[model samples]
Target chain A: MNYPSKLIEQAVLEISKLPGIGKKTALRLALHLLKQNEQTVEGLTGALSRLKKETRYCERCHNLSDGPLCTVCASPSRQENVICVVAEVPDLIAIENTGQYRGTYHVLGGILSPMHGIGPEELQVASLLERVKSAGEEMEIIFALPSTMDGDTTSFYLMKLLKPFGVNISTVARGIPIGGELEYTDEVTLGRSILARVKYDFGG
Target chain B: MNYPSKLIEQAVLEISKLPGIGKKTALRLALHLLKQNEQTVEGLTGALSRLKKETRYCERCHNLSDGPLCTVCASPSRQENVICVVAEVPDLIAIENTGQYRGTYHVLGGILSPMHGIGPEELQVASLLERVKSAGEEMEIIFALPSTMDGDTTSFYLMKLLKPFGVNISTVARGIPIGGELEYTDEVTLGRSILARVKYDFGG
Candidate 1:
């Protein structure tokens, strides 16, 4: 049968664009919206509008921020001398949810994947280095980057570049099943990995 | 610890307000936005913005529309002499999907749920009666409303009101489970219900 009004079709088309939502499911969602109270539907629509108008990124850590610096960067009690490097912001949140780590974070934007055309330039690696250098020679860096090969490569590269400052460089313990996504792993295992961290050697 | 930023917190809060989304899920969604490229994140944000700007209610059917009349109302070939009365837009879509019925529809908005303070006034029942009266004596109305108590109440009310105009009043077959949702039952069952519909008795 022919589709409903163009507006309904448009709603279905747009919803289908969401992750894992197909045409059938999209139509179902669109119709569900029709059944909801006008106020509830309007609320959802309003939220979507505000998402663009209200949100921005933290310039310093690349975490979502409403201001120039992220909240973590503005905080006084967190270890300013210790920065934990991570592959992405989700990884940072996973660590934060455990309520264990008190250090600040550096979101790399992504892992170094030459195959995907992702390089150091694509990541926030340069900003991280700049932040570390400015934080001082006494600062120790922790490469809490993911356990993937690309993550290892990124960690190794950062370690070598920072060796001139004679700062401490350590990577999280590796028995984490290489290529495993850190966000899905349990906190106990992740904490154990952090405690069993190993030192990285650079020829500098 | 202090939050990452007010913008991030607000975004998370707004996300948490969505159906089935909690604080932790909101955090995950917010972090996902941070890790994504600006273009990808903006795409989702852009879609959200368009959700409200482009949709409105069709005055004729009270269905969500981008214009004054909804898609079903705008169609030319649909039968005007017959109207299938349903409780919601999703029910309308389910019937439409079967490709069996060719009549136009009137969305009742909801069933008559007195327990929830939802009555005929809250629903589009008045509109259904008005449409029936306006459509004139030649029209036939098949009550495709659900089998729940509220459905029965709504159907009885509509039958009596529409009967005065000499228009035919019919209802969909009723083996539907008591208090069952119209959205989940299979197409075959729904169509069977329509075929087995019996005449309503007005307290003989």
Candidate 2:
């Protein structure tokens, strides 16, 4: 598209670099920004700049943090004895939102995707191993990764590495989601559900 | 979504305020920015701030411009006597990209929409009328707007106001799009095509 100004073109170019945004969508966004008040634009830019400049990685869990450790890792109430492993900070947030898990988390940054040149070396695999081996107390490592091939591969690789440590390794359950219709459920999930069906028990 | 950090939450809130973007998409975009280098984020923010803070509108036609007059309006090669009126700058860009018209453009900024509380005063309608009335040369005004109700209403309103002036008035043609299949075309478009069919000449 022939943008009217260099500034608009530059802004559109930068915005379109985002994951799902395209040039047209970027142009729309830029035009919308142009229509907004100067303070709104300043606030947006300030927030983005602060987010990029002030953000840090948790030393222990590798989650996004404003300091050396993330909130979960810094919290005394969180259990370090059982660490739930996730692929990214958003996954950690998702698990935290469930409010059922009391354990600490280990963020792998991303799963192993060989096609994308993302392997164990590129991830936090070695650091995770070091954490597990050096811990004084027994820690149960739970793989909270997705059920995708990459997630399974990463979990298996970690499990193989941790076999000698004698620590309990587990994974989150895979089945049809609650309130999901049986007819609408995918075949893989349906098959897994049947294989891992729970025994029916009536209430007391 | 329950964001872990106040910075992330604020950034998400600001980003989500853009048209068509929602909280989840905003979170994804914010996290993507968090993972980028500081320079990339700075470039985006700088471009946005410059676009919002330094951008100006053309005094003659209300088009987005860096100076008092827009590039088209200031260009000597552009015909000032024939003006193509559009709802926004993007429409002007679209027409320019077509490479079919060499006339100047008058951007209305937006079409009339009473439902959204937009009226003639909210647009550049008065300025457009002043330009038409005070022009040193006779002019032909071509209305290039969407076929929406608001676009039609705004065009008709301007037409009625310009009736006293002997200046020629016209509208961009509307019918089936080029290379479009008749079978798959919508009913309104098909009916309009039949009503507005152009005269066909077999040979010159």
Candidate 3:
């Protein structure tokens, strides 16, 4: 599209570089910003600049952090011995929002994807191994990655490496989701759910 | 959602302030930006800041421009006596993209909307009248605004004000879109199309 102004065109080009935002949406966003006050635009730009320049990764888990450690890693109430291994910081946030797990997290940055040139070395495998090696007592490593082939491969590789450390390794359950209809569930997940079924308990 | 970093949270909050962008999409965009290099992030911020601070409106048409006149208004080939009146700069751009019209444009900035506290005083109505009055010869004023209640009200109000000036005032045609099926067409549009039917001509 022929933009009326060069500044607007440049802004639209830069905004369209983001994922899921096309040229039309980018134009809309730029126009909306133009209508806003200077202070509002400054606020957005300031936040984005600070987010990129100042944010760091947690030294222990590789999750995004403002300092050396993330809030989860710094919190004393979280169980340090149980580390939930996730593929990225967003996954860690998703699990944290559940508020069901008291364990700390280990963000691998990415899963093992040979197609994408991502191997075990591309992830935070060395740091995770060092973390487990330095532990004084037995630790638990839970695989909370996606249920994709890449996720399975990453988990298997990590399991083999952690076996020598004598740490207990487990994976999050895979089955029909709560409130999901059985008929609509994929065959593989349904079959796995059946095989992994536990005895029903009536006692509260 | 509980963000792992305060910077990420702040960025998300600011980004979500944009129209149509919710917290989840904001977080996704923030993470996407975090993954980009520093130079890429700088490019976006620079473009946005320049778009907000350096951009100006055309002196004649009120369209977005980097200088005193927008490209359309500054062009020598466009018909000076024929002005297409639009509600906003985007509408002007849309009409320009059609390549069918060779007339200049006058942007009203917004339509009449009493509910939103917008009126003739809030629009560029006075400037439009000044331009029409200053014209040395007969001129044509075409309304290309949306076919909404506010658009109709604004056009009606402008018509009454421009009638005394003796300019040939007109509006864009309202009809079913090309390639639209009559079976599913809305009743009002179909009825309007029937009433405003043009003469069929085979001698092209």
Candidate 4:
């Protein structure tokens, strides 16, 4: 669509480059920015620019960090022996939000996606292998990656590599969601949940 | 949710301040930006800053503009005697895209909303009156505002104020949309369409 101002057109074009945002939404956002105070717009731009310029990845876990190590990797209370393997930082954050897991995380950056030209080398596989090789015999590795084929492939490849290290390898359970109904649950997940069902424990 | 990096948290906070963007979506967007190259992030921030700093409103019509006059107001082909009053720049652009109208526009900035503390004094009502007073008797004012209560109130208020100018006043027709079916159409709109039906012309 034709824009009244060249500046607004340029702003909308740049905004629409982001994922899930279209030209119409970008235009609406730009117009909204125009209505806001100068300080508000400046604050938004400042925060985004600082995030890009100052943020770094944890050298150990590959999670976003302000310094060499992320808060998870730096925390002493976290169980360093148990590393939860995730496809990305957001996945790590999701697991952290549950508050049940106290283990440290190893962010893979992405799963193995051959279609997208993302192989084992494209991710943090080498760093993960280095960590596993140097860790103690009691170290446990938990795969918290997606249930997709790419995620499974990445997990299998890593498991095979880590076999020689003699560390315990496990994966998060796949089942119906907490509030999901039986009839609506997909067949594959339902079947997997039945096959992996645990013993009924009487104590809470 | 706890973020791995403080910079990511700040970026998410700023991003979620935008319309329709929640914390989860903001985190996703922030993570996506982190994955992008530094130049892409800089380009977006630059465009947004420039849009806010450089853009201006047309003095005559209050439409967004790079200079004193907008493209529509500056165009010689546009009819100066006819004015299409709209609620906002987006509305004007929507009507312009149709290519059915050749008249200039008067942007009200917003409709009359007492709940939002927006009234005649907050909009471009004074400027519209000034323009109407100076124009000739043949000048016509058309209301192309929304069909909502606020839009109607603004149009009615303006119409009453412009009555003494002896200019012709009218509003855009309200009817069923081009591809709309009568069965699914709302009762009020369908009833209004039947009441406002025009003579069917065979020759196109």
lDDT of 4 by residue, A1-204 (tens): 889999999999999999999999999999999999889999999999999989999999988988999998899998999999999888988898999999899988889999999988888999998998888657899999899988899889999999988899999989999999999999999999999898998997
DockQ of 2: 0.68
Q: For residues B1-204, what per-residue lDDT tens digits would candidate 2 score against the true structure? A: 667677898899999999999998999999999889889999999999999988888899988887888888888999999989999988998898898999998999899999999999999888888988998989899999889998899999999998787789999988888999989999999999899888888996
Per-residue alpha-carbon lDDT of model 2 for A1-204, expressed as tens digits? 777777788889999999999998998999999988999999999999999988778899898776788888899998888989999988998888889999998889899999999988888888888899899999899999988998899999899999899999999999999999999999999999999999889979
Clashing pairs in 4: none
Question: B35, model 4: CA deviation in Å?
Answer: 0.7
Instruction: Write the residue-wise lDDT of candidate 1 on B92-169 in tens digits.
Output: 877888888877888888888889999779988788777877874498899988876788888998888888888887
Model 2 spans > 4 angstroms off: A113-121, A134-136, A179-204, B114-117, B179-188, B202-204
Who wins the lDDT comparison? 3
Interface RMSD of 2: 1.2
* DockQ metric for all predictions: 0.24, 0.68, 0.90, 0.86
The most accurate candidate by TM-score is 3
> What CA RMSD would you report for each candidate?
8.1, 2.7, 1.6, 2.0
Q: Which has the greatest DockQ?
A: 3
**Which CAPRI quality tier does the interface of model 3 achieve?**
high
* TM-score between predicted and true chain B, model 1: 0.73
lDDT of 1 by residue, A1-204 (tens): 345556667666665665555787667666656555666665555554455456666777887566777777777988878888888767786778778888888888888899899988998988987887787548778888876688878888888888887788776655555788788777867887788877898869
lDDT of 3 by residue, B60-115 (tens): 99999988999998999999999999998889878888889999999999999999
| Candidate 3 chain B lowest-lDDT run of ten | B89-98
Return the TM-scores of chain A for each candidate in numbered order: 0.77, 0.93, 0.95, 0.95
Comparison by DockQ, 2 against 3, better one: 3
What are the interface RMSDs of all the models? 4.4, 1.2, 0.7, 0.7
**Candidate 1 docking class:** acceptable
